[model samples]
Target chain A: MSDILLEIKNLTVSVRNGKSDIPIVKGVNIEIQRGEIVGLVGESGCGKSMTARSVMGILPGPARKSGEILWHEPDGTVTDLTGLSEKALRDMCGLRIGMVFQEPMTSLNPMMRIGDQVAEVLRIHKLVRNREEAREKVIRLLKEVGIEEPALRYRSYPHELSGGMRQRVMIAMAMIGEPGLLIADEPTTALDVTIEAQILRLIRQMCVSRHMSALVITHNMGVVSALCDRVYVMYMGRIMERASTGQLFANPLHPYTRGLLSSLPRIGKNPEYLTTIPGNIPEAGREPVGCEFCLRCSDDERRCFFERPSEIETDEGHYVSCFMCQRV
Target chain B: MSEEILISARNITKSYSLGRKKRHIAVNDVSLELYKGETLALVGESGCGKSTLARLLMRLIKADSGRICFEGTDISALSGRALKPYRKRMQMIFQDPASSLDPRLRIRDIIAEPLRVWRVCPDKTEMERRILDLLDMVELKESMIDWYPRELSGGQKQRVGIARAIALDPELIICDESVSALDVSVQAQILNLLKRLKKELGLSCLFISHDLSVVNFIADRVCVMRGGVICETADTETLYAHPGHEYTRYLLSSIPAIGDDPVS
Candidate 1:
């Protein structure tokens, strides 16, 4: 039996701009197993967020999407969430599937008290029969996420809390319903190093203890190595490679993955030898005929310019979509 | 320890009254120094008063009780016109370059403002000459002289910031999270430029950042701060190789390296 909680296959997303339709997420595929952490690694404007947003059925308008987002229910039944209505989506979102957005400031309601805000989800979803039970559960959730003196913090507004504490609140809010899957999109990018480490550790710990799978979208490769067992490397709008953490770092089959690794700077190393990816991410509308990363690839092969290749499983539990990697 | 100190802070403390019985001790009794031609990194989480300490050194806010000696000058006590000359010798580059520079001013005028205000050069023509030189020194094209702050990239605007800070020829420059907003490649460029400027200008820098990897590249000495207190301080090599404090060890261990074990 497939252990996947979420499976996206050949997902294509296009947005209408001016006169023509543009494909931003050309063809992407990802799978998140139960209690598994999958790192979606890409640079800025590489459609990582789009993929995550699409999973939550929250992609903004002017964007057209196609393909299967098969979310296998806990009841052993499969559900197609792509065409769900807004109201239905809302009920499903905070209660069943929670998201920790990139910017917590935008994710949270600024004017409301954090306790009321956390309790709002329970009230909206009717998870609790009474206000007293909801209030108690909210405080418990806050304390569970490592917020100190949860009762005192319940009276504080989002603005009153520090950034690190606010993030903890966000985490607390996300875990109120104990959602089966959590999508953390650049959750620690805005945070300082120490606070970021704490958050990362917390998220990793909760994934196992809560029995919830997490989809972590970030550009930092080190975060992936630390937190993810499996990773999907996205370049432009497409997933160039997918592999277990060991196999991906040990043997990165895709050229884009290789370039990204070489470009990242390490601590206490010779700064003079730091390599850089030569070209910027391609414009959304104008994509390559073959490989999306062909222009930036160090060794652009002949087949890469003319033929688009599907993800080929060359190793067990590892896949790369590059034409060059397709050869024996 | 042999290198002559450029700046020193002895038992720096700062507190702000919150209008009640509570007084937030923003910066505790902290002591540190910057050495000539070396980068001394101040690493800490936010609310740890690292930025407040930077402001304290800049004299933006007076310390409650402490002594700041800048190159044999007890600048901590000096004020008004008495502190003017010391101000010219030291300058700061803020984190956000987009807002740091005035939106309305042209690039030439922005850089030349410091030169004119400090009277570093006599005539407008000489000022123009030096402004162009500063632009060149910061690796910015002279064609950008007519553009405003809004027209430049984050990196280019930051270059303009460097150009403005060095207009008066400061010996010590404080870069506060200068490249944290930038991508890694662009950050490397700025780091290289700063590293190179230190050599050519014989300047000392107090680099503040939350990223240990970036600090490790530039810092000769690293001081770890927590809850507005200096938890540990040592030479960069020693700090990384053998951390002394639990907080320091936690900070060091948090640095993510590729292929390393994810969890300990």
Candidate 2:
């Protein structure tokens, strides 16, 4: 039996314009071991969310995707999600894989009761035999996610709960199916700091107790540090760096990754001026022929501006894609 | 830092009617002071009345009770023509740069609107030169002067917003989560720009934010607010090092720093 739960190979997602295609997510590879929490960190439009959407078979309108999304089943069966039909993917989604989005209010139904909305996943998947069974399961899951008084609050509307409580309901909805893989895309971005800590803790707890792997997509490095075991730094549709959390923080090889870490305003350390990446992320399909970060990278050389750098293993289990790293 | 007060709020309170019989207090009996050329941060979670306090200080809404003074003049009660001059002296930068900027207007015209309304530059060439100079001050390119807000990135739009806020050389600027919408790298750039502008122009700022790390970076003083009331107020160093209020301590601890251990 292999430990690999999900493996994405040479994935590419693009959108068509009038006469041309704009590549949002270029060829990229990511692997998640069973029960491992990996982070995909990047700025907006950097294709982190698009990558997640590709795996879930929920790419937005006009976007086209290709390449392999291999899902390793518990019974030694390997299923390629990209080859699955719409109907087949729908069957596999809630039963095999679950996802939580950033905004709970928009993702959840405002008109439906919170309890019914959570139980709908079970009903669709046929996990519960009857309405009574669904209600009991939902109350238990809601309680597990830390909703105080699950039975009383089950009748409440989405608007009746606070932001943190709404997010808890979303988590319960995602967890009810008992999927092997959970994808959380910026689950705490819209939350307050105190509430964000609570949500992150809950996600980590859920992943650990169920022994499920998770792919957390976010731009906040702090969130990555707090939740992810391994981190992948993405920039302009390519993975700039990948390593374990400790190594990535202690020794960031990619200039882009280093720049991001340095730019963050630490809680205790107050520097006179924060280091900044000078240029904005280039428009999709207009990235430089060389390194995608070459325009803003301070360590760029002639080769860095002309040839795209390939991923190189600088140390054990640490990978970086930069001409500078290759030379060192 | 000078001890001279730039703007002061005294016992300010604001409440909204939730329904026919219920009321929600947004801001409650809050008092604050901003010294000359220093940044005072108002830190709190959502629904904590930080935004409402900012609105009260900006005179965007009338307070239920208490007074607000700018340069020793009580402007809370002033209105219409009498309050016109004070309005130019105090400007604001909003959270969402995309919506705060006029989408249809070009960058040049958007910045020039403030100058034209205030008659800062009446001559044609002078106005053009002034607009270009303002763009330069904010480190924006000359070519982007003709671009619309939709064509610009989030950071560039925010730069444009700052240029307009300072077009009249306002003495005070109220930044309502000004850098919250930007990415980390861009947020750093904007913060440095704001710091430089404060030093060069001697502008006092009321920086409101929910992110504590940001507040620690840019603010000289900090005020921790909860449920529409301030729980603690102190210098930034003292506040971060040894929080007096339990709520303040909890907020400082809740921040997820890079070096902190992952929740196991």
Candidate 3:
């Protein structure tokens, strides 16, 4: 079987306005392998979350998506997700793939018991035979997520649990279907530092134990370095750079990527000053005519203001798009 | 260096009733001191009462039993008009700038409100000049003075918040999770701005936040709190290098440091 579990090819998403289309997610490509944890790092309004939602076929209303999303099954069958019927897509959502959102409080139904919520995933996929079987599976899944007193927590509402425990329940719900691929959008953004560490560890452990793949969407580089094997830095709906986590951090090629890394404030070593990107992200559909990041590039050249730079492979599996990088 | 103390809170405690005769202790007998022209960080997790402590120090809410002295004068018992002069000396920058700013007012008016309330700037031209100067101090453009809060971005709104807080030339500013709502890059910009302003204006700050890494960057002294009580207090370097309390150690361990490997 092919090790490539999910592949995104030139995916684009745009919103329809009055006689115009506002491109939110420009053409971008990403690949996730079996048992690999990949990071999609970007700030707010950078389209990282939108790209993840597109992978799940859950783009919000009025947003039109295009391009190919290919899912390679363990049985050697490759399916194009964009061409699938609504019924087929619905079936594939829970059985073959799963997603975790930033805020678990809103994702979970406050009215329902935690046990029924996890069991509902199994029942919807027709994975369990009866109520007794579902109860046993739910208890085991809760325990697997490191929830103490599975029997007691099974009947507890989401409000009764703390933020960390609620997130664990959300993880249990997502992993109940034994999906081959998972998409997590800012999974630890709303959590405290201690709780964030636990959640990140839980996600990594679950993925490794199940031999599943993940696409972690976050703006935190620390989280990326700790959990992700590879990283893609996104900016204003486009992928500016992609490389292994170590390579990306050691030698960031793109100016935007370098600015982002340098702008982070560390604990001990305080720099004299931080390098800011000079300006805020451009409004959607109002990006520069040439390079999207040219407005904020400190070392902008003449060509950068007039011509868009194509993706250049600087090293093995390391890609960047910048006129300045091309000269090197 | 034995610096002059700016404000002192002695034996502060606060509590709220939980409907059925149960008392929820938000803050319990916590005392700390802020020095002149230095930053003191109050670090804790959610529901740890760091924010409640800030409110009590600012006198936004009365403490159950305590004495707060600002510049050697007890301000805890002062109320209404008696507190007006102290209010001008101590200002606050809230966490959510978007909500804290008045949406109907322009940036100029928003910043000039403090000066106008205190009668610091006598006339229109003086207020206009100070407003412009304040905007420039925060690195905001002169043209943004005419813009409303709703028209600005998150970082821009926060800059406006800082401009307003420093408009009255306050001696101390209480920044309650001021940078928590910002992105990393923008947070850096704001932090650098605050550092510059502190040096130029000789301002003392009480910065309250849940993120220890941020506290390490800006704080000269760190106070770790949990469950309405202070667990440890020490210099930033000492506290980070060798935590005196178990909770402080756990919090230090919990920060997602770069290059730390996730357990498989």
Query: Using DockQ as the measure, which candidate wins?
Result: 2
Model 1, residue pairs in steric clash: none
Kindly list the per-residue Cα lDDT of model 2 for residues B136-233, writing each as its tens digit: 99999988889999999999999999999999999999999999989988999999999989988999999999998899899999999999999999
Docking class of 3: medium
Say which prediction, candidate 2 or candidate 3, comes out ahead on lDDT.
2
Question: Can you rank all candidates by lDDT, best first?
Answer: 2, 3, 1
Which stretches in model 3 have alpha-carbon errors above 4 Å? Answer: B260-264
RMSD of candidate 2 to true structure, Å: 1.5
Candidate 2, residues A31-97: lDDT per residue as tens digits?
A: 9999999999999899999999999999999999999999988677999999999989988888778
Instruction: Give TM-scores for every candidate, taking all chains together and pairing residue i with residue i.
Output: 0.87, 0.98, 0.97
A1-328, model 1: which lDDT tens digit per residue? 5688988988998889999998888778889899999999987778899999998888898888998888888788887778677787787788767889877777779999999999998998989999899989998888888998999999899888878888988988888888988989999898877778789999999998988999999988888887888999988798889999999999988887887776665665546544655545556777788888887788788888888878899999999887788775
TM-score of chain B of each: 0.95, 0.97, 0.96
How well is each residue in B1-264 modelled by candidate 3, as lDDT tens digits? 237888999999999999899999999999999999889999999999999999999999999999999989999999999998888889999999889999999999999888887788898998899999999999999999999998898999999999999998899999999999898878888988988898799999999999887787788899999999999999998988788999998888887766533211
lDDT at position B239, candidate 3 = 89
Name the DockQ score for candidate 3: 0.56
Best-to-worst order by TM-score is 2, 3, 1
Q: Give the root-mean-square deviation of each candidate in angstroms.
A: 3.5, 1.5, 1.9
Cα lDDT of candidate 3 equals 0.90
Clashing pairs in 3: none
